[model samples]
Target chain A: MRIAYIKNKLLTIDESFVFRVKYQTNNSILSTIESEIDTVLSVEHSEVLGALRNNDLENEAIYIFREVAAQFERPVLLFSGGKDSITLVRLAQKAFFPAKIPFPLLHIDTGHNFPETIAFRDKLVKELGVELIVRNVQDSIDQGKVVEESGKYASRNTLQTTTLLDAIEEFKFDACIGGARRDEEKARAKERVFSVRDDFGQWDEKNQRPEVFDMLNGQIELGQNVRVFPISNWTELDVWSYIQKENIEIPSIYFAHKRKIFLRDGFIWSAEDDVVFRAEDEVVEERMVRFRTVGDMSCTAAVLSEADTIEKVVGEIRESKISERGARIDDKRSEAAMEKRKQQGYF
Target chain B: MEVLKIATAGSVDDGKSTLIGRLLYDTKSLTDDKLEAIEKTSKQKGYDYLDFSLVTDGLVAEREQGITIDVAHIYFSTPNKSYIIADTPGHVEYTRNMVTGASTSQAAIILIDARKGVIEQTNRHFFINNLLRIKDVIVAVNKMDLVDFSEARYQEIKSDFEELMGKRDYQDQKITFIPVSALKGDNVVNRSENMTWYKGQTLLEHFEALDKEDVYNVGTPRFPVQYVIRPKTEEFHDFRGFAGKVYGGELSVGDEVVVLPSMTKSRIKEIYFYDKKYQTATRRSSVTITLEDEVNVSRGDMLVKVGDLPTVNKEFTATISWMDSQNLNLGNKYVLQHGVNKVLAKVENIHHKIEPDYSGVDESVNSLAMNDIALVTFRLNKPIFYDTFKEHRTNGSFILIDNQTNNTAGVGFIE
Candidate 1:
């Protein structure tokens, strides 16, 4: 099908361009023949007829990105070097094709991230020609803003909130776009697409603003900002499928590789990093495993898999019986772990 | 694969959660660890059967209280389509939450306990679904096993629901009646041998056989420009495109379009989706379009076909659903958001409060409190181009944000 502007009117033509000829001829028989031909052509290409197809998730994300750009003066993307955030980066790129991504990526590094993830993050930023802003939880701890947790289950994951809030204040970002999906955790399921945060960066779960239809209310006070999750409607499989469809580059840890690991609480702990605390009795061994979720080395666990390629990884996720957040040790702490963290502005 | 969003509504103990869990379980969408957790929790609680509510009730308070407090999104996909079910709390107090869940959904499932038949809660659920113009509604008469799987009882409830359907304003809605026991695994994903007298599609079969294209492909094309994409780079110095998602219908290149608020006429020069350009833009697809001439187009401005212009006015009547704790009285000001456009608006008059249970309207009501639905008139500071809610879902609906707290106070559907 083809559309053209002729005589100041929109006209659609099929493969034969019979409509144009029929219009020129002004014959009733020719018009009937043209209609018949159009019907046949439409039926033949019915499967691929629609202009949208099944790209609702991507389209919604792109629309949210544009809304953030239009509504807020200064907006920044919260990049965690994870698959969800990486998908957000690509969506932002698609939102404005010829134009560069309007906002810079804000990475609140826990200082316990994998070296491979950091390298991947830097490379992605350089290739996209977008600015990268890094803030460290250690800096916040050194500044006496937040205290580091001690003992066995200590993770810098919660401490990163302080650094993130500080960076938001420093940059005065009115909107912080994150790649949090609703299907990840229970508390996240109740999140709105355009979530509002107060001056203290607190999320009011019970008294959330009602978001109706596609109209997003981004109205906020001077000190307050909105945490926009474009992919809130997307699930884990959707992200993997989108990544596979786009052929986007990701960290090597996502694929199966030989890594030194130890088992703790039925989870495979990466022994390659000193950030993960292991008891003396916990013997290290080599295993063919891959990371299902990318978080701080202390929290994220590896699943036993041989899915070495994107297609294989997507297939593994499709067939696997474990939820994505099941691999994240933070959620296993309590039933309300995600909700409590979210109320404290932990994105 | 296509994603179908569904909202489930039922009062407490109606087995709504179990029905959802059954759908997930039968489809093999629930992961092993999640199922194990549910099983462990169920066993610890010393229940004879697995409490499927544990799968959706995520909050600690909810678990302790044994009730859903808010809407919880549960995802599961079959080979044909991906499904996102908004598990809304079925309570008299959380009517606003139910509406919130149904607003974005294309379909809804109203669970009716077979023993109780169609109660007042069922009336409210059906009324809300009609108000939201949800296309597909499945009235699942659950707990059929408890009622001995009697086809007579199912027919009785179906007729009761059909009587309530007469009170609905929107007659175009399609409501299907199904008999199923959410807990007994009967007529949910598989046909029930006990209810041999009944012959109908199972819950999963009904969903699979739905015409997905007819769900959201109606109404006139309405494109509300979200943002203006301007690439002032060295290569493309003067590229300015209007970016937004197309709602209702398709828009093609060379369409004589008019920019709203400005009423400036222009033709669509190009329709670009990311790096590729298309001759036509389909409904629900987000694309950037460049006009033939450089018009003063900005965010919140709408691009529509010249012949199909919406009502441009400053004052209008709407059916408002109040959501905030504070009451909405006459003369109260709010930031009215219509699509991407924002304007200050004040309540001009309070018409009447419409009861959700198909009861008559109350005219003596002067103010609307929480969970109240009423017809109200609003005078906008600036004129907005809008259509009736029934005519254009996206163009006609709006949200009222409180000026002081910035909380979404009410949602209005234009009359």
Candidate 2:
């Protein structure tokens, strides 16, 4: 029990102290002293209750970022200009403050991203004074490394994995720090903080090194890379709370605005842009919408919301009935869509 | 809000996944889309009841096999606090998965099938929880509907578990028992009216009543330097900060500190969480510190209070949990990573292998195979500051990286 002092004179005891005395067979002396300290105890109890809690998750993430810096030869932060990645950048900054972030940033562009997201990406990198490496899925397609899909429900989401692999090989990066939270998808729920990838960038779910306590093992062989998710334990609300608390800047597309979108299979697809495939019968209509998650325009869905501010967006997320990934069209492809993609080295 | 991480362990047929799914469903943590998917799959599977395992069995292979293959983390929050549950497998890769899951958890839930009573698998679950030194243990006697929710059956299992508890070396563990029907959703989140005699708090109530401080072990402060932040810029040209996380206890400015490996003494000039300077750095907080005197402190060097020092030694004995397929033999070298410090370690001797069922220790062990837990001595190339696992968990534990494979082959809890 913590002994709380009042004005450095009075000694205060909480309810647990009294309960312990009462449970004793004979404690007449203790009871007498408890009565004198009862009033002071109540005052201290409220103070303890109202104490500002420390952000342990933030501390943990900073530790992980430091480990990646110290353990790997070349580490890069995989930025998607999304809220989670934005939070990761702030954490990285906090990890090595008073000094520039040691690593660069990598963005695997699917070439179908929101223009606002692309704009935000460039601004954040410049503000941080960090190098940004952008690789396009179109480049992979043009080089015949990956084939583009062409169907009503086709998306370039799966094609980013090839480009990401090419970039990793090109840079010879030993570690890729990503913002893949466990709360986003089920396959991610089983992910390790320091997930090891084979030469082909495949994740062996069956055989994974057991991580115990704060000791994260980052040792890996040559030609193998580790995918480090520092915020693997954070949830969607935690991210929003962090953004609101830290006052981090994000892309404007996250807020609610009037946009031309079409309805298909109970999903709202952006129609103002020609990036997404639209059928002849699929009609376009304007709706006040915002994206819960940012990805390829063809794969990302928007919800009917009026949250134009960060605070309002947080409230909307708190009261939301649907999961954040519900807006992700790629996950709806199959029950094992994420697992299959992850095995193929999807960030 | 405080976050309480829990690890749940059960045999293949003990309804472990069902309990987690039920807990999420009853608490309304499962979103509408997730519920719909579960409903759709349950209907297609032609089951009268919902296949709760579908909510946690994320992999297609796991779904096809109807078992958990890895530890899947699940998150839920109430107004008071937040919870992170590590749902791990028990049958296939028991030790590796169970130890991995329980390592970071402050509490654990060991599920027992009411019909099957106390089994060997139950002993393994209790053993790992004890080995990992989990502070709180909840013995959930599940499938109460099948046992008629009988008090006699519950007490019988509790008594059996108590016998196993008596065999454990670490006796400070707090244990609680709850009778639940995970499939029927009784006594998991809500009280069970079927068993009116049982007056203990429900599983959810147990979590709600727990204080965060009680779950965490308080010990001496040990700061292992992770990085050194030096701007070398004109504005703060002479700024030198030792960046690290404070473990076990708090460190305040002006406190006398000693740098490890080279016992140079210095006082804390400032504690910076970020930009703002704090008078004190709380436990588990990642903060950068500027010393009053320039000390040769770098990554892998620890900073401790002048009077409170850890054992700086070149060799020690530890209880090892082997995770690799190859056997751990005498003279086998590994990269021993303790906190941020990495040193080359060679296995000196395999003392004995302890049985997970609390049967006894076998002193005749020559080599440690996969999933083997044994007492072994390791000699390090250089000195490492450590404490007994019982004294300070973070400072006392270490991981062994296989030199050839470069894999985390085993974990050690210093004795």
Candidate 3:
């Protein structure tokens, strides 16, 4: 098909200053131009590219992304070894190429992560040659900054917040890029793309500044850092599609496989070791399973499925009756489990 | 499959929660753990049958009062579509919350108790949905079992709603009527065995058949620059790009573009979605574009083609939905947030307080109270490029923030 291209002359400053100037252009030509430019641009960095490619969310991802990349003296992608964070890493790479990712990668270790996720996290940082800063939740617990919960339903999801806040304070990071999507949780739905946190790292959900067209309000007093979600609008399906389209490498546990798992509180608990408590009433057995979301191994449950391939997994998600959070045991504690955690600075 | 977002509004005891409970129960969307919790909670409260409202009504304050205070998002899916129900409060005090919930929704379900045919709450619910331009609305006259599946009552309420729809600004909205007993699991997820007079699809069946066209899609593309992504790495150190999501339309490379405020002109040099480039970036994709020329641009600036310019002005008229407890009166200064731009604005005129019951406008009103929707005018400190809310949702709408408290006091849909 012949591409319709709109090649108009550039305007001088005094010509016009309106925000949006609509012009007619061929759809095919526009797409062709995008493809042609992508071929020539050398996006060596991984983090920026991950974000850049997963661009099917909010329109401002590309525009504010350029601003954030330029504004900060030092910026970092908070990589969690999760699909969302990994995608941010790739976007950061393409964001700044030739030079390594402009800033270091920070990881807040919960001390209870799946082994494969941790392994993948290390490999990614090593391959990208960017500096890696790891903060431990165990350190926070040991220092009495956070207390460990007792019993079978215990998790370190809330403890990671302390470690994350400490790292930000220690590094004085002005802006921390996150992979949180607004569609994932309700409290997050109320969050701004450029959410401001006080020196104490608390989200003022009620007073968020209105976010309008491509501009992000990055104005904040000193000691107040910003939490920027580049992919705030991307749903679970969009992320998976981008992964499949880019062939981005993920942990093996995401695909279906056979493993020894036990049903406790009606969730598929991995029978890995003593890291997770087991009750005598629960029956343990080996079963074929896969994880939809990768969180703290104790809290993240496995689902019964045969979606071993990316295409199959995407298809399964499209037709699945239950929500992605259905496999999570932690949320079963209460209706506002996620909201309460977010209020206390848990990301 | 497409995603459908619906907002539910009804009276305090109109079985709004029960209707939602029935949907989750009949659809089998409730997981085993969630079901167990509901059963335990319901039994503890000494209910004989499972009180489905226990599944939702999450807030501690709400459970204590047995009422929904805020909007709670509930997710469920059928074979063809995924649904997000914004369960909003029915009380008049929470009318603002209802509007907030319905603002993003494509459809709305206004619940009516079978015993109480059509009440004032129903009018307010319909009014907000109409004001927000929700395209599809379902008037679910709940508790049909109490009325013995009476078709006469259903017709009465449907006719009442038709009278209210006459006052709506948008005439193209499609409104459907359904009668069901939420407690008996009839006509919510499955076709009712009792309502033989009803010929339409069941609630779930009706929802499954809706295409994207039946919903309120995003308006014209509005690209609000969020942040700039510039990685000054050694290999390609000179690369500069603007990053943001496109609100309504697609942007492509090699398009003649103009930057806002500065009005710098440039051609789209490259469009990067990670490493690979595409010909066009569709609505809502966060991509970076490098301009062909080295025009100076920064945050809070917009980029678009040369001919399609929005209205650039410092003042305009708007319809405001007052949210705060404080009154919205003339001469009150507030921060008007238009897209990503914030400008100081003052209330220039207060035309009238729009009665929620679709009654005639009250021109005597001088100020708007909480939950009051009014048509007002404002004067901004600086020129804000915008379009009518109907033309471009992203650029046309705005929020009002009280300068003293910094609270989002009101929302404005451009006139």
**Best prediction by lDDT:** 2
| Model 3 ranges off by over 4 Å | A1-78, A87-105, A127-131, A147-158, A172-246, A256-274, A277-293, A298-340, B216-222, B233-238, B250-257, B262-270, B290-292, B326-329, B356-358, B362-367
Sort by lDDT, best first: what order?
2, 1, 3
B100 in model 1: Cα distance from truth in Å?
1.0
- Which clashing pairs does model 2 show? none
List candidate 1 segments past 4 Å from native: A1-54
Give the per-residue lDDT of model 1 (tens digit) for A201-288: 9998877787777878888899999999999989898899778767789999999999999999999999999989999999999999
lDDT of 3 by residue, A1-347 (tens): 11112111111211111101211233234334444543433342222221222222323344445556655665667888888888777666655443366678888888888889999998998899989999998999999999998888888887788898899889998888888875565455555677777888887564455443343556566787778888775667667756765568998889999988898766788897566778887788999899988888878888898989887777776556566677877776776787677666667
Give candidate 3's whole-model lDDT.
0.74
Provide chain B TM-scores across all predictions.
Answer: 0.99, 0.98, 0.95
Model 1, residue B391: what's the lDDT?
93
DockQ agreement of candidate 2 with the native complex: 0.33
**Candidate 2: segments with Cα more than 4 A from true spot:** A1-53
Over A1-347, each residue of candidate 2 has an lDDT whose tens digit, in order, gives: 34444422332333334344443533334444544454455455532221112677898999999899988999999999899999999999999888889999999999898999999999889998999999999999999998999888788999999999999999999999999999999999989999999999999887888888899888888999999999999999989978876778999989999999999889898888888999999998999999988898888988989999887887788778899999898899899999999998997
- How would the candidate models be sorted by DockQ, starting from the highest? 1, 2, 3
Model 2 per-residue lDDT tens digits across residues B207-247? 88887666889999999999899978788799999999999
Flag the better candidate by TM-score, 2 or 3: 2
